[model samples]
Target: MTASAALTVIQASTLTLDDTQPRVEAVLVGGGRVLARGSREEVAALAPRARVLDHRDLILTPGLAEAHIHLVAYGFSLSQLNLHGARSVTEVQAKVAQRALQTPPGTWIRGGGFLLSELGLGGYPSAALLDEVSPHHPVLLYSRDLHLSWANSLALRLAGITEATADPQGGKIVHPLGTLLEGASELVTRVMPVPGEAEYLAAAQAGADDLAARGYVSAHTMAFEAPEAPRALQTLAARGELPLRIWACLPHERLAHARELGLALNPGGLFQWGGVKFFADGALGSRTAWLHAPGFADGSGTGMPLDPPDLIRERGAEALRLGLTPVTHAIGDRANHEVLNAYDALRPLAAERGVRLRIEHAQHLDPKDLPRFQGLTVSVQPIHLQADGAMIRELLPHLAKTSYAFRSLKAAGAILAFGSDAPVAPPEYRATFAAALTRRDDEGQPLAPGEALTEEEILWAHTRGPALAAGWADEGIIRPGARAAFTLWDRIGGHAQALVL
Candidate 1:
């Protein structure tokens, strides 16, 4: 029971992947590392007294890693009003009304999961519809993509948003109805009371537990929530209660504060600081994706860019010097190109610091920019391909073949770290796998079938690619000296449950 001693032997149909194939009777564990991994006899001779934890016929692979997730925010969202699958405006209204009845008047009723397209609306829905459902309570519902939001009149009024209110920078207010897009959603959010320490801690726990339940053993939590979100996670890690290993990013705005606090890259058991996240553009669903020469195919004038490369370059170096990876949100071609340029300038420095610069969406790429992802981690959500396909065809037809170009990206030598981008897309790997492998959209239209990835490729992206993206070399692979984190199942890439450690 000393640091130099080994204690347990885990036997299974090991997916050591140490040599790219599954092993039948591997013995591993007890040193919190792979103490020994080989035929059962080989490992037993090395440490016969090691307590045995047998997985008789189960398949064992490296623990799955969700490269990108908004942990605390996702957790809080789970308990909030869920409107994710409402097919129509009426369905949304009915759900909001039902939730309102369950809560006292004047309490803020917040939920998300509505798709503007699914609502059968050509544009953003108005606040008037929601007003009719919860006139006494304030309500704000985010689009399934998290790019747009629909709020009731009361909520709009509380946020001081009116017909005369001008759209904020990088965001738009849909006319006549009071729905907000991109940056505009902040208007309503700013007025909401921040959760106390307890609330944050609880939400963090809920979110982490939910992901673990879905078979994720580690995650890279993007900074999209209050600072307390990560603080709550830190609290859990300190207590050794965090079930999944976490790599968290700080918002770019917080870089100076982190620097001032002397915060640097860290590994505190189940959690660590991995990067700083910035937004170069908004999302596709909200119509904020920054595009190329001839913007959206529908003529929306290429989407707007949120941050300039000049600024990203200036701040990115500082981030690297402090051991923080620079991760930017780039959904459109233009957005991806600009981030790539900035990263190109910082790549050498990033390498020197052992950091890997990353692009969060790399969803829609320009053919020319596709090659830029080589050696860089492109953290993408294949699940969004279903909903984005129709919009891609309608709004950005020219890039259709290359959009969500997993094959092309991989061929270009890019490290594709697949994720659900949860809260934006649900945290379901099966959906991610199906979407990437099938390339099927909501209308059953197959988009870029040639770009589809195989099931094995998809699994590798979700596991190894993400671990590499998060800079956790000790994870995502079943090998000597690697953490004992893993997911076991009756079958691989199918219905399964997390193997409790």
Candidate 2:
């Protein structure tokens, strides 16, 4: 297309997200890069022979980048049992029982997207609830957070988990043998059938297509899914079928292997390995996000911490030396505090290497640590506030004032990158924009109105901030020499479509 196409001009009300020239009337594109951007007459004179596509009524901005997602898994989830809005166990049972009849008797049933708190459970759910419906089929269901799993009796038995089975490190097996938290879910996942190369490729395509359809021109694929997931994505890029550019991570557990393979940060491509992903703790919905004292007002205790802080400190330095950003996931206050401490130690090295330290989810935080984010990339999902707001009130009321603090983070000098963390939530930018602008949850209740961001700030976070985090300078803006990838919106925060040159 680049070789055959003539230089083209797009005339739109464009939000460039460029401080020096924030708005432009026209942009000239050729060979997949911006040639010039300015008033229509000025740019048109420069490319008088260029084809023109007018969009005076729409708003065009830098193409969106989904800053965090499990690409392949979210793709497969589009075909799995979705318990997203199941209000009760009965509702969930009906879905599972129906699937059971369709599936083989001994087959494993897999799906997720129900919050334990939302399920009206006093504690962990029991296998009996599922056994009543699918006594023949082994069933494994995950809570919305993916940090907890509810397994039926047969599923538990298949994994050889019983009352005698001890909890695994970084995870827990709830009493009565039905619920597994954190790393314990691996017991069942490891036993489940693995997808072959063909399945992986298909899942990868499904995810990339869905995001592209949602108006994303790029995405940061967080590495928590199977290793085959990234491989499938890379395969898509190599085949030139990938719809969007990708900035991906490798699980910290694979750090040693990556070092041995000589894998390091390699930027500028349709896909690139950019960071080493580490989980410092679990999620709030699962009651496993490591918190400070008196955690979870409901007496769930301080949430479970995942990786050791020391590991992050030590290996993080190693990661920086190898040119890979050390990306740590820290949802709770304690988790963020600890990761920040580890990051502090890595700051000098990070500065030396010109790589930014990144923290994902920075959801709940201690006010004192706010300033520490000055030079770091804080990847957050405002969409999560739709549900987590209510949970925070019930579970961590003390944080209600500071939670989802987009405005505060910005003031503290952090580069705020927004994303959906799809499957956990949809990559619906409308929902994300609404949550950020209104500071409201699903119930239409305000979370922290003071933390709300303006439409321009929201656009920057969704576009330019992600590009900065991924170390891509030619993206997330409309300017000379920038990539000709953009999103056309009917309104500031509404229906959108991708337009990649």
Candidate 3:
């Protein structure tokens, strides 16, 4: 018998996420899709001779999806220096020195996950500390937010950046030459060796495998990486080596090029390009999130704004015309305000095209801007609350009540999609579950208790919300003809394992 045509009956305790028949005792599968879902007796009678796989002890939920992640980059980060919890510069130096001890003198070393505030620094960190540890090897490390980069002198010299090097548009070269903010990072990244096709393929495989192991059946790959990143993923799909279904976006600057190449929203596959991405501002940790007056309570000037709202407004319409979702990254109040204004202009056209606009990281918001998110896909990483909670209280206390407003956004008519933005944070759903349900941050402090969501709501955000955002009708639920992909759990929000037919 052909493998695709083989029949089986899976008996389990299932939450279908379908209002019509939310609970199912047995599911009949054939050709990699669910053929029927019903009581064990009913389905058993229909597929009498089908092989039976019983797991009545476990709970089966719709497979999870990482709503926002830089897949390939995350894969590569698996081996890079991880600095997620170092509380002091000395701690970071020790780790860098160890890595350098094992590496060749001239090899470049890279890794990231540090937060300035977490490190207890009031201003930018000097590269001298890193230089002291690894003067022979160039080192480049990114902050946990991915909005800033700290490099040692050797790395900076290699990038040809000095006091004479002017800041690139939309980026900054923090004086004293140790850190690069926003656009300024590109200067060094551009100078770094581009990964060849093989490295890209390896990263793609490693990333997809890691997520599959964590019970993610799908992911929406964000578009901050180079073109090779997507191409590598496409290669995997073509070779049938891809383990997770991918819905990816391209940077908005590629919109004209995309139109020329006739790339648009094409659904139905292991991979698809469904959105065009834009960035309105940087992240809060970097003191670069574009904000309204009184910006950061720390007295850092209003953060740097990246893409102009006019550009998002004009180009967003173009993306919608191609049946593509215009996804923008808006972190601070002013950034969200400007993006909401820009999306307002696209609303009519987006409605006409039957498209849902998306906003990534609606992290901190003005009360006035909260309601404006209604009807948009607010794709956020609940995992961020674990670290960002304390920072919000210290840096932007004015918005604390509304920051990461999960319940408020959901009540306001927004489709809340959860993700981890991995590499910045590990795509661990347990952390997501805890952070979302508790509304607490790193220090065991609650930021906005009222904004906490129930476990079920968090599941919906990680499943159905992302499916709807990607315009996938058959995923995020269990029904006849649905993809035969599920996540088995000991109980709701417990240990998970993927079960894809």
Candidate 4:
């Protein structure tokens, strides 16, 4: 008996993409594998009992994948009151005050998505500002970029973070204002109540369901959440309730524990540990994007560097030794340059291990360093282009041409994996498709019209590129031996609906 001979069959008018783009026929899927794909008659002859799923006139392509996202954080963010488009400080304060009244006292209210530049404020918001609205309850509002966090005085006192507190390495406290940057955000978080197992599972299920509804069948989850996040996914998968396949990552700090637990790169199951995530620098919106030569267009100094290059290179090798892929966040030109340098040093090791090193948000690249990303996966968020467009024009106008340079990076031989750095930018694939293809921002500003990608390219980047980035050979494709996963839609670029045949 053939291995795939026992599975079900799904037939369509146009079976799109099997070793090539769009073809007519049927696919036999059994044991979660595409046993065979060919003309309807050919496949039907093999699995007569394989219940047929018909999408006669619909396009059947590989399932979509999100190359970069924070799973648990995105899930938790869904429950929090979002402040993503708040125009001014007063608006943010008002929103917090409203939530504060609804939430019980001292509930540790949290919400994100306020742009420093959009607020018409010159500097970052301070504890004093938030204290005005949420003096009784602890409030922590993260900047739109998720790089800087503003906490109320009550939250600071609870975390015992005083002015005299020393800045953690690669993090800073914004002077008398008392805002925490990067690693410093952890101090306040360490004191927050850790969610129980129930919250974790609920968030995971909710997060996964939301993505599935958006037509994403898979995602590469960047690690920033408690380990319970992946554990929750595993629970769902075990119960046959997982909505989408997941590739989970670990922070470099967790490598020791992973090794102690004897976990290696097992690329099966709905959830798999695929890479070790690192932050090479802060974010652009937070004014912490590490840049080279000329800094922000504004008078502020160049962005802050997060993880030292040498540290990344050293720890990256350690991760490679244990069969883990190295993924780093590099937003600014300088940050991208530093990560490229480190990756160059470790390329041989990564190649020997058959692992691909990825740099998240190769958002801005130095003209000189643009070629360095060749052959590397550039995981970028097109939706962020909507918000960062104005900032790019104002802060680094000279480099604006290459900012979120999707076409340039792809032309340079870089694999472009599109995603929404959810919570930083929400996971709206349709918006990503529209922004990348149109190259227009919310204000209809043409940030870089020349950098726009074609609709076909955008689709590939959203689907195949991300699967390749996660090293999932069997996903994001429709072919024999590939995962029997797909997404159905009313139209190609129209409404998306999950097809779980």
Candidate 5:
């Protein structure tokens, strides 16, 4: 069909997710928007000459949205050495050695997605472990959670991190040298090579295209990478090369820069600046999650708090004043509690500014603090449950009941926005559906079966929840005035593909 076709009709077993008309047999789209949706004959009648494509047995739903991700990072991770499922130190060494053989000897080797626990490590791994594999290359492998990094001696020396090097504020250098936790990872990162603008653009494009191919129409890119990451996405969007809508966040550290540049929340377009992201604590896998009293049963200390409560409070108000949502990452119980406390104080300001307060990865929480999430956006990643399940049971046993409490959060009046923290976990919709719907761990055991959600609820969280979080009125819904982006599925959470009419 020509690009200027008057209309295109798609017929399927459709789930519009529009309360007014929940299900439709066909939908008519034109001008990149839905024109009408109804029974096959009715939609066809509305657009007599419309190009019709029928898939009567397939299920259709609003385009999926990934509420939290590091878009550019995910793209880069695609090309890096994958260590996602490495089960032992030997497996990790072998992977690094194989990559080392392919690369220049002195080049920096970077890759991640391995859990220490999964690697059979009783504690943080030393640089000596990676050294055994790639002694010539400066190797820097991030923990699965991305909160911890296992660096080789070469990399550590390149970053000037030694046994005597003091830990930076908000992060730790595990004793005996090699592992960096929380903000401490920056010690090496700052020394690692920075990708050029063109590289950044290519990474962003790759990431967006990857997500689009997997049926995502939009993504809320959490700001955890360099500024060039979002800049690249913006560059692609301006050139009409971006495949998915991007709602990006500015690093809270860049708040001053954004404010000085008069940047506020800009809501439409393929790419938009929507919020400022802050980390309240590190991640669970890193043993850096900020927990309440009686911390990890394994005694790794009460997790490392990243951004201080006062910082979130003061900077969050500034972000609210600038009409930007204060999106804080709080995976630990204490992290969530502290962030909720800050949000409680900033709620009035947020309301006055017409912005929503958002908490990313409210993974673990205290039962009493669940209600505090009321009227706020809770952006979570069910995909994480697949990996964190056993860790949660072992470390935060006391809070295990409320960890990833999707049902409880929803019942407590919180808006549920779902996402896969790509690179941390693959942005696979099926995995998200399975994790949320089954509440089953990697071992097929339920962590908290009562937290299981229905297929419809999971669909809403993946679609509408992200829309609300990004303040997009036209996306994540199938209606007359909405964007004509949809996902066709063989079954509710089965194989799916994106369709942009």
Candidate 6:
């Protein structure tokens, strides 16, 4: 569309989220940018020959942005056996058994999204539980939080993880033969079937399209999967087949290679390399969240620390120098604390480079450390709160008061970017809205009720926060010269759909 061409005016109860003029009745678009936004009559008059779409009952806002997700993994997960809401061990086995029946006897069966707590298990589940159902097929099911994996005997034997197997650094192997925590899970995963380039491309396309259908115009894909994952996304973007804009990260291990290839942060594309990702600790669900002092109330130890502070400080400095944001995953309080320490040291370099230091998951933090998040980006997942609420209460009751502290982090001057760590939880915007606005868990209990945000705050976090995190000035807002990407909702964050010019 040319600038001289007649504009397309979208009429709705437009919540622009623009501070100067927060609400407008209509938005005029031309050349994929917001040309004008005002009252229906005003905007209509500005674009007299414009094609008008009238939906005054619906609410239109800036397009939603998924702040953190594993795009390729989520796409692959779409085809995997879903164990998301399986409430019992029997239920989990039944699903696995059903999947096994459809497959050849000896094929590996990979699935995830079940919590040990939800399974009513007092401790880590044994392979015997799964062996009883599918002794022939190799099975590996991950915990809801993706921090732990449960493997059946066949899968274990394939990986050569016998009773004598030693735990890898920064990981654990739960005895009695099934669970692998942190790095230890890689043992079985390393031997599993690797998706070829074609599979990777398909998964990337599936993930992007899925998010677009869910009203997301863009996503910041955190690097947890193999480098092939981003390569596939890049291929999709180059072919113009990717439906959503993707801001991806390079795993810290590849930072040297990225720098060698002169991979500076590139903005303004369907896909861009935006950050360098690191893991400071494990997750909460697997009882692997790194905590301080008394650790897990149940005496499960203070979780596991993955990347060391010195390594983060050194490598993070290199990432900042290369124009990539240092995105650290710090879910537990201790992890957050140590990461903050590293960020504190690297703050000067980050400021000098004009890159925001980002912390992913910051799930549980001490109140004293919360202030340190000021002037940084805290990319968090509110949807996880629904499932982690009960776990937080039981495992870290002392820190429950500040867990998933969205409102607090925002108040502390931290930019809060909301996302669904999909496959861990579906990228359902309603669940994100419900969890943030209501501060309620799945058990009908409120978790740190004070951390609840207003509908507007939630919307801003879902939109503007992510744009800022990715350093995209033109996205996540509806204004002059901004990208013409939008989401229309029946109510603010109710049922929604994407509209890209």
Error at 370, model 4, angstroms? 1.9
lDDT of 4 by residue, 83-188 (tens): 9888998999899999999989879899998888778888877889888888899988888788889998999899888888888887888877558888889989
Candidate 1 vs candidate 2: the TM-score winner is 2
Candidate 2 is scored at a TM of 0.98
lDDT of each: 0.84, 0.92, 0.92, 0.84, 0.90, 0.91
Tens digit of lDDT per residue, candidate 1, span 1-501?
A: 232234677777877656654574765576467656788887777776767778867877788888888998899899988877678989988998899999999999989977777788877788888888899998988887787888888888899998889989868888885688888899999997778999999999999999999888899899978889999999999998898899999988889998999998876588899888889998887778888879987676888789789889888999999988899999899999889999999999998998888889888888888877888888989989988888888888888988999999999998899888778778988888889989999889999899999877887898889988877788778777788788876777776556534
User: What local lDDT does model 4 show for residue 27?
Assistant: 73
Q: Candidate 5 lDDT, tens digit per residue, 1-501?
A: 333347899999989888999998998899899878899988877777888888898998999999989999999999998998889999999999999999998999999999998999898898898888889999999988899999999999999987889889878898888899888899999998889998998889889999999999999999889888998998999999988988899899999988999998777789999899899888889888888878899877887887888999999999988889999999888999999888889989999988889999999999999888899999999998988888888888898899999999999999899999998989998999999999998867788889999999999999989998888878888888999999999998899899987
Give per-residue CA lDDT, model 2, range 106-207, as digits (tens).
988988999876778878999999999999988999888788999999999989998999888778999987899999999988988889999999999999
- List runs of model 1 lying over 4 Å from the truth: 1-6, 20-24
For all predictions, the C-alpha RMSD in Å is: 2.1, 1.6, 1.6, 2.1, 1.8, 1.4
**Per-residue lDDT of 168 in model 3:** 91
Better of 4 and 5 by lDDT: 5
Which tens-of-lDDT digit does each residue in 245-336 have in candidate 6? Answer: 88999899999988889999877779899899999988888877789979999888898888998999999999998899999999999999
Residue 440's C-alpha lDDT in candidate 2? 88
Q: Candidate 1 versus the native: TM-score?
A: 0.96
Residue 298's lDDT in candidate 1: 66
